[model samples]
Target: SLVKTGTGELTLSGDNTYSGGTTISDGTLIAASVNALGSGDIDNSGVLKVGEGELKNTLFGSGSLVKTGTGVLTLSGDNTYSGGTTISDGTL
Candidate 1:
Protein backbone atom coordinates (compact mmCIF):
# COMPACT_ATOMS: atom_id res chain seq x y z
CA SER A 1 0.00 0.00 0.00
CA LEU A 2 1.35 3.42 -0.93
CA VAL A 3 0.28 7.02 -1.42
CA LYS A 4 2.07 9.67 -3.44
CA THR A 5 1.85 13.15 -1.89
CA GLY A 6 4.92 14.96 -3.12
CA THR A 7 6.29 16.68 -6.18
CA GLY A 8 7.79 13.54 -7.65
CA GLU A 9 7.15 10.75 -10.15
CA LEU A 10 5.96 7.22 -9.37
CA THR A 11 5.91 4.44 -11.90
CA LEU A 12 4.23 1.07 -11.43
CA SER A 13 6.16 -1.45 -13.45
CA GLY A 14 5.28 -4.61 -11.57
CA ASP A 15 2.19 -6.38 -10.34
CA ASN A 16 1.11 -4.52 -7.23
CA THR A 17 -0.66 -6.45 -4.48
CA TYR A 18 -1.57 -3.48 -2.32
CA SER A 19 -5.17 -3.16 -1.26
CA GLY A 20 -4.89 0.46 -0.21
CA GLY A 21 -6.16 3.17 -2.48
CA THR A 22 -3.82 5.19 -4.67
CA THR A 23 -3.96 8.90 -3.96
CA ILE A 24 -2.08 11.46 -6.00
CA SER A 25 -2.38 14.69 -4.14
CA ASP A 26 0.54 16.57 -5.67
CA GLY A 27 2.56 14.29 -7.90
CA THR A 28 2.43 11.83 -10.75
CA LEU A 29 1.32 8.18 -10.59
CA ILE A 30 2.14 6.18 -13.61
CA ALA A 31 0.51 2.85 -14.35
CA ALA A 32 3.02 0.82 -16.26
CA SER A 33 1.58 -2.57 -15.43
CA VAL A 34 -1.83 -4.12 -15.73
CA ASN A 35 -2.39 -4.56 -12.04
CA ALA A 36 -0.85 -1.32 -10.90
CA LEU A 37 -3.91 0.26 -9.36
CA GLY A 38 -4.70 -2.63 -7.01
CA SER A 39 -7.97 -3.09 -5.10
CA GLY A 40 -9.12 0.31 -3.92
CA ASP A 41 -10.33 3.73 -4.86
CA ILE A 42 -8.26 6.37 -6.63
CA ASP A 43 -8.26 9.95 -5.45
CA ASN A 44 -6.09 11.74 -7.93
CA SER A 45 -6.15 15.48 -8.36
CA GLY A 46 -2.59 15.88 -9.54
CA VAL A 47 -1.53 13.77 -12.52
CA LEU A 48 -1.97 10.13 -13.67
CA LYS A 49 -0.74 8.46 -16.80
CA VAL A 50 -1.12 4.96 -18.29
CA GLY A 51 2.15 4.10 -19.87
CA GLU A 52 1.36 0.50 -20.72
CA GLY A 53 -0.71 -2.56 -19.77
CA GLU A 54 -4.31 -2.57 -18.64
CA LEU A 55 -5.57 -0.58 -15.65
CA LYS A 56 -7.86 -3.42 -14.66
CA ASN A 57 -8.90 -2.09 -11.32
CA THR A 58 -11.96 -0.55 -9.79
CA LEU A 59 -11.37 3.15 -9.40
CA PHE A 60 -13.01 5.57 -7.02
CA GLY A 61 -13.10 9.31 -6.28
CA SER A 62 -13.47 12.31 -8.60
CA GLY A 63 -10.24 12.42 -10.56
CA SER A 64 -9.42 12.17 -14.22
CA LEU A 65 -7.05 9.59 -15.72
CA VAL A 66 -4.86 10.85 -18.48
CA LYS A 67 -3.00 8.50 -20.84
CA THR A 68 0.47 9.40 -21.99
CA GLY A 69 3.87 7.98 -23.02
CA THR A 70 5.03 5.79 -25.95
CA GLY A 71 2.84 2.69 -25.89
CA VAL A 72 -0.70 1.40 -25.98
CA LEU A 73 -2.68 1.40 -22.73
CA THR A 74 -5.60 -0.94 -22.39
CA LEU A 75 -8.00 0.05 -19.62
CA SER A 76 -10.25 -2.88 -18.95
CA GLY A 77 -12.06 -4.44 -16.00
CA ASP A 78 -14.97 -3.52 -13.73
CA ASN A 79 -13.99 0.09 -13.22
CA THR A 80 -16.16 1.95 -10.72
CA TYR A 81 -14.04 5.09 -10.57
CA SER A 82 -16.03 8.29 -10.30
CA GLY A 83 -13.53 10.66 -11.87
CA GLY A 84 -13.49 9.79 -15.57
CA THR A 85 -10.99 9.02 -18.36
CA THR A 86 -9.18 11.40 -20.67
CA ILE A 87 -6.69 10.89 -23.47
CA SER A 88 -4.67 14.05 -23.20
CA ASP A 89 -2.10 12.73 -25.65
CA GLY A 90 -2.28 8.96 -26.08
CA THR A 91 -4.43 5.95 -26.79
CA LEU A 92 -6.83 4.49 -24.19
Candidate 2:
Protein backbone atom coordinates (compact mmCIF):
# COMPACT_ATOMS: atom_id res chain seq x y z
CA SER A 1 0.00 0.00 0.00
CA LEU A 2 1.05 3.56 -0.68
CA VAL A 3 0.31 6.27 1.81
CA LYS A 4 0.89 9.95 1.05
CA THR A 5 0.98 12.48 3.84
CA GLY A 6 2.42 15.88 4.78
CA THR A 7 1.76 19.22 3.10
CA GLY A 8 3.62 18.87 -0.17
CA GLU A 9 2.97 17.57 -3.67
CA LEU A 10 3.81 14.06 -4.82
CA THR A 11 3.86 13.19 -8.52
CA LEU A 12 3.30 9.69 -9.82
CA SER A 13 4.56 9.16 -13.37
CA GLY A 14 5.33 5.51 -13.72
CA ASP A 15 3.12 2.71 -15.01
CA ASN A 16 2.76 1.19 -11.60
CA THR A 17 1.41 -2.25 -10.79
CA TYR A 18 0.95 -2.25 -7.06
CA SER A 19 -2.34 -3.74 -5.89
CA GLY A 20 -2.11 -2.86 -2.24
CA GLY A 21 -4.00 0.40 -2.91
CA THR A 22 -3.23 4.06 -2.12
CA THR A 23 -4.15 6.31 0.74
CA ILE A 24 -3.76 10.09 0.76
CA SER A 25 -4.17 11.60 4.17
CA ASP A 26 -2.92 15.09 3.43
CA GLY A 27 -1.30 17.31 0.82
CA THR A 28 -1.44 16.66 -2.89
CA LEU A 29 -0.78 13.64 -5.07
CA ILE A 30 -0.29 14.36 -8.75
CA ALA A 31 -0.90 11.72 -11.30
CA ALA A 32 1.45 12.62 -14.11
CA SER A 33 0.78 9.68 -16.31
CA VAL A 34 -2.04 7.44 -17.47
CA ASN A 35 -1.14 4.46 -15.37
CA ALA A 36 0.58 6.35 -12.63
CA LEU A 37 -1.78 5.24 -9.92
CA GLY A 38 -1.88 1.60 -11.00
CA SER A 39 -4.91 -0.64 -10.67
CA GLY A 40 -6.17 -0.49 -7.15
CA ASP A 41 -8.49 1.24 -4.75
CA ILE A 42 -7.71 4.81 -3.69
CA ASP A 43 -8.66 6.38 -0.40
CA ASN A 44 -7.88 10.07 -0.60
CA SER A 45 -8.47 12.40 2.27
CA GLY A 46 -6.45 15.19 0.69
CA VAL A 47 -5.77 16.49 -2.78
CA LEU A 48 -5.56 14.40 -5.92
CA LYS A 49 -4.25 16.26 -8.93
CA VAL A 50 -4.42 14.91 -12.41
CA GLY A 51 -2.13 16.68 -14.76
CA GLU A 52 -2.30 15.18 -18.25
CA GLY A 53 -3.37 11.60 -18.51
CA GLU A 54 -6.01 9.00 -17.86
CA LEU A 55 -6.80 7.48 -14.47
CA LYS A 56 -8.64 4.18 -14.12
CA ASN A 57 -8.56 3.68 -10.41
CA THR A 58 -11.46 3.26 -8.04
CA LEU A 59 -11.45 6.31 -5.81
CA PHE A 60 -13.37 6.62 -2.53
CA GLY A 61 -12.82 9.15 0.22
CA SER A 62 -13.69 12.55 1.59
CA GLY A 63 -11.06 14.68 -0.08
CA SER A 64 -10.87 16.70 -3.28
CA LEU A 65 -9.56 16.17 -6.81
CA VAL A 66 -8.06 19.03 -8.72
CA LYS A 67 -7.26 18.98 -12.40
CA THR A 68 -4.36 21.12 -13.39
CA GLY A 69 -1.83 21.70 -16.18
CA THR A 70 -2.58 21.27 -19.87
CA GLY A 71 -3.92 18.43 -21.98
CA VAL A 72 -6.67 16.06 -20.99
CA LEU A 73 -7.07 14.12 -17.80
CA THR A 74 -9.51 11.32 -18.41
CA LEU A 75 -11.19 9.40 -15.64
CA SER A 76 -11.99 6.04 -17.19
CA GLY A 77 -12.90 3.69 -14.42
CA ASP A 78 -15.40 2.93 -11.70
CA ASN A 79 -14.50 5.75 -9.34
CA THR A 80 -16.38 5.74 -6.07
CA TYR A 81 -14.77 8.71 -4.37
CA SER A 82 -17.14 10.85 -2.37
CA GLY A 83 -14.99 13.94 -2.77
CA GLY A 84 -15.20 17.20 -4.60
CA THR A 85 -13.54 17.51 -8.02
CA THR A 86 -12.42 20.79 -9.40
CA ILE A 87 -10.93 21.89 -12.68
CA SER A 88 -8.32 24.29 -11.56
CA ASP A 89 -6.44 25.11 -14.78
CA GLY A 90 -6.99 22.60 -17.48
CA THR A 91 -9.33 20.07 -19.01
CA LEU A 92 -10.54 17.25 -16.80
Candidate 3:
Protein backbone atom coordinates (compact mmCIF):
# COMPACT_ATOMS: atom_id res chain seq x y z
CA SER A 1 0.00 0.00 0.00
CA LEU A 2 1.05 3.64 -0.54
CA VAL A 3 0.47 6.77 1.51
CA LYS A 4 0.56 9.57 -1.03
CA THR A 5 2.23 12.88 -0.38
CA GLY A 6 -0.19 14.94 1.70
CA THR A 7 -1.50 15.35 5.24
CA GLY A 8 -2.67 11.85 6.02
CA GLU A 9 -1.84 8.95 8.28
CA LEU A 10 -1.85 5.19 7.66
CA THR A 11 -2.52 2.94 10.58
CA LEU A 12 -1.98 -0.79 10.54
CA SER A 13 -3.09 -3.41 13.08
CA GLY A 14 -3.55 -7.19 13.15
CA ASP A 15 -1.87 -9.54 10.67
CA ASN A 16 -1.63 -8.27 7.11
CA THR A 17 -0.21 -9.19 3.72
CA TYR A 18 0.07 -6.58 1.00
CA SER A 19 3.58 -7.05 -0.28
CA GLY A 20 3.59 -4.34 -2.89
CA GLY A 21 5.62 -2.28 -0.42
CA THR A 22 4.87 1.04 1.34
CA THR A 23 6.12 4.50 0.50
CA ILE A 24 5.38 7.62 2.55
CA SER A 25 6.40 10.74 0.73
CA ASP A 26 4.64 13.38 2.76
CA GLY A 27 2.81 12.28 5.87
CA THR A 28 2.76 9.88 8.77
CA LEU A 29 2.65 6.11 8.55
CA ILE A 30 2.10 4.07 11.66
CA ALA A 31 3.02 0.45 12.01
CA ALA A 32 1.42 -1.58 14.77
CA SER A 33 2.52 -5.01 13.67
CA VAL A 34 5.80 -6.77 13.03
CA ASN A 35 4.58 -7.24 9.53
CA ALA A 36 2.56 -4.09 9.42
CA LEU A 37 4.97 -2.45 6.96
CA GLY A 38 5.13 -5.66 5.01
CA SER A 39 8.20 -7.77 4.15
CA GLY A 40 9.70 -5.08 1.96
CA ASP A 41 11.87 -2.05 2.59
CA ILE A 42 10.05 1.14 3.59
CA ASP A 43 10.93 4.25 1.64
CA ASN A 44 9.83 6.88 4.08
CA SER A 45 10.43 10.54 3.47
CA GLY A 46 7.93 11.34 6.19
CA VAL A 47 7.01 10.12 9.68
CA LEU A 48 6.76 6.47 10.77
CA LYS A 49 5.35 5.56 14.13
CA VAL A 50 5.60 2.14 15.70
CA GLY A 51 3.01 1.91 18.41
CA GLU A 52 2.99 -1.84 19.18
CA GLY A 53 4.57 -5.08 18.15
CA GLU A 54 7.55 -5.02 15.76
CA LEU A 55 8.42 -4.28 12.15
CA LYS A 56 10.40 -7.15 10.77
CA ASN A 57 11.39 -8.76 7.51
CA THR A 58 12.58 -12.13 6.30
CA LEU A 59 16.20 -13.17 6.74
CA PHE A 60 16.24 -14.43 3.19
CA GLY A 61 15.57 -10.86 2.12
CA SER A 62 16.67 -8.38 4.72
CA GLY A 63 14.37 -5.47 5.54
CA SER A 64 15.29 -1.85 4.95
CA LEU A 65 14.18 1.65 5.99
CA VAL A 66 14.60 5.32 5.14
CA LYS A 67 13.47 7.95 7.64
CA THR A 68 13.22 11.73 7.37
CA GLY A 69 11.35 13.67 10.06
CA THR A 70 11.83 15.29 13.45
CA GLY A 71 9.05 13.32 15.12
CA VAL A 72 9.98 10.37 17.30
CA LEU A 73 10.05 7.10 15.37
CA THR A 74 10.90 3.79 16.94
CA LEU A 75 11.67 0.30 15.66
CA SER A 76 11.49 -2.05 18.64
CA GLY A 77 11.57 -5.13 16.51
CA ASP A 78 13.86 -8.12 16.69
CA ASN A 79 14.62 -6.49 13.37
CA THR A 80 16.18 -8.42 10.57
CA TYR A 81 15.64 -5.35 8.35
CA SER A 82 19.35 -5.06 7.72
CA GLY A 83 19.44 -3.30 4.38
CA GLY A 84 20.84 -0.34 6.28
CA THR A 85 19.00 2.67 7.76
CA THR A 86 19.57 6.14 6.40
CA ILE A 87 18.12 8.65 8.81
CA SER A 88 18.51 12.27 7.76
CA ASP A 89 16.50 13.31 10.82
CA GLY A 90 14.63 11.85 13.78
CA THR A 91 15.26 8.61 15.69
CA LEU A 92 15.23 5.09 14.28
Question: Please, what are the lDDT tens digits per residue for candidate 3 over residues 21-63?
Answer: 6666766666654456666656656666554334454221233
lDDT of 1 by residue, 6-79 (tens): 88888887777888777787777887755677766666766777766666665555556777766678766566
Write one digit per residue (lDDT tens) for candidate 2, span 22-50.
Answer: 99999999887656777678899999887
From the highest lDDT down, the ranking of the candidates is 2, 1, 3
Q: Can you list the residue pairs that collide in candidate 2?
A: 59-81
Rank by TM-score, descending? 2, 1, 3
TM-scores across all candidates?
Answer: 0.67, 0.82, 0.52
- Candidate 1 vs 3: which has more TM-score: 1
RMSD of each predicted structure:
2.9, 1.7, 7.2
Q: How many clashing pairs does model 3 include?
A: 1
What TM-score number comes out for model 3? 0.52
When 1 and 3 are scored with lDDT, the better candidate is: 1
The candidate that achieves the highest lDDT relative to the unseen native structure: 2
Evaluated with TM-score, which candidate comes out highest? 2
